[model samples]
Target: MKSAFIILLAALPFAAAAQTTQAELLRRGELTGTRPSARSQARQTAPRPANTASDPVQQHLLQTDVNLAQASADQLPSLYERFIATTRDERRQWTYPQWDAAGQVLARLNQRYEQVRTTLPLEERLRVRSFQGEFHTLRGARQVKDKLD
Candidate 1:
């Protein structure tokens, strides 16, 4: 049981990366570069959010300046589906701000999942767990991609 659990946990990030790698986001952007626009650049340069959050999850969200907390308990499955759809098939023509905005929406979706985790149906919760990991993985990958190039 322990080994199986360990293997599943180890593969989660890989699975997430497989769905949407950092390189993929950069390659799909129209500007041919990962540079932020003037407005996003200003937001990035602005003073960081306060670090007073006791929860690690809240702290991470603050650090990214992308709050994607979802408010609707009944919307998790559909929202995740929409996210997956947008990212997979429709975002190829997007620019930097669109990418950034998508990232923010992704963040909110994850937060909404967190908000309703306990209240969700078993199948919905399970489905969201998969999406939540993918979003975090994508966010981490994108943040690294931005920093590197």
Candidate 2:
């Protein structure tokens, strides 16, 4: 009876280890799997972009700027209106960071417009002023939303 009790105690650890799955052992750092391949190691070590431009809002704004730059005077109003509409729609879905990024872009765009205002035709300048006004309005709404949050 004493020998049987000693044997049971000795077998307990083996029983627990046998119940542990291979994945569980790996997760606990008690086992090692195959080494990562060269391709995987290279991917892990690769340098990332300084500005990944991962934000969709920033990407859209860049494309919008390109479109605005190429637009003719006759197309300016329609382009501006489309931009305003898209911005309004996207504003509702934006996170705080996204909204802040948009605000920065709008502010920069307004500044650029102001700097070149004298070079632009009067009609074009007026259109840019309208865009700046819309940007301010959106910014005001964002501020109010931020306060509520």
Candidate 3:
């Protein structure tokens, strides 16, 4: 019975060591913790901004003039479509100078579209063609208004 008591006392330290947490062991530098998983490490690192542009059109539009001018002309139709949609929403609130600027941007975009029409993808070319037809109709209506004014 005295031998059993001595064995139990000797085993107490080992049992207490087993109950110690991984963090505690790591802090004590006695045990190396398992390396973090790739997914877990990524979560711990700096996160990307939620508002950053992800769409190609948004990326192109947000680029500086030099970068935008360097972009593939094949992307013009989509960029123009995005521009038109944005301007259309703000048209009612635009000053004359703002409208003029939009018109100048549209003209430049149209020129770029013409230059790359053949090189553009079939879908983009078709979209531009449709947009051109609608644009002309709108221009004709605007012209009549201008003549009357």
TM-score of 1: 0.41
Off by over 4 Å in 3: 1-68, 133-149
Ranking by TM-score: 2, 3, 1
Q: Flag regions of model 2 displaced more than 4 Å.
A: 1-56, 62-82, 145-149
How well is each residue in 1-149 modelled by candidate 2, as lDDT tens digits? 99999966866655454354645433332222224346535643676333333445544765443433233454444444555666777777777787567655554343234334456677776775576467556755665545545
Query: Each prediction's Cα lDDT score?
Result: 0.52, 0.52, 0.50
Per-residue lDDT of 54 in model 2: 49
Model 1, 84: alpha-carbon shift in Å? 1.2
Tens digits of per-residue lDDT, candidate 3, 4-60, equal 999678666555543546564333322212354464345436552332234343344
Q: Could you tell me every candidate's TM-score relative to the true structure?
A: 0.41, 0.44, 0.44
Instruction: Tally clashes: model 1.
Output: 4
TM-score head-to-head 1 vs 3, winner: 3
After superposing candidate 1 on the true structure, give the runs of residues whose Cα lies further than 4 Å from its correct spot: 1-71, 135-149
State the lDDT of candidate 1 residue by residue for 66-130, as single tens digits.
23343457755766765665565544455567556666555545434544567778888777667
Task: Give model 2's TM-score versus the native structure.
Answer: 0.44
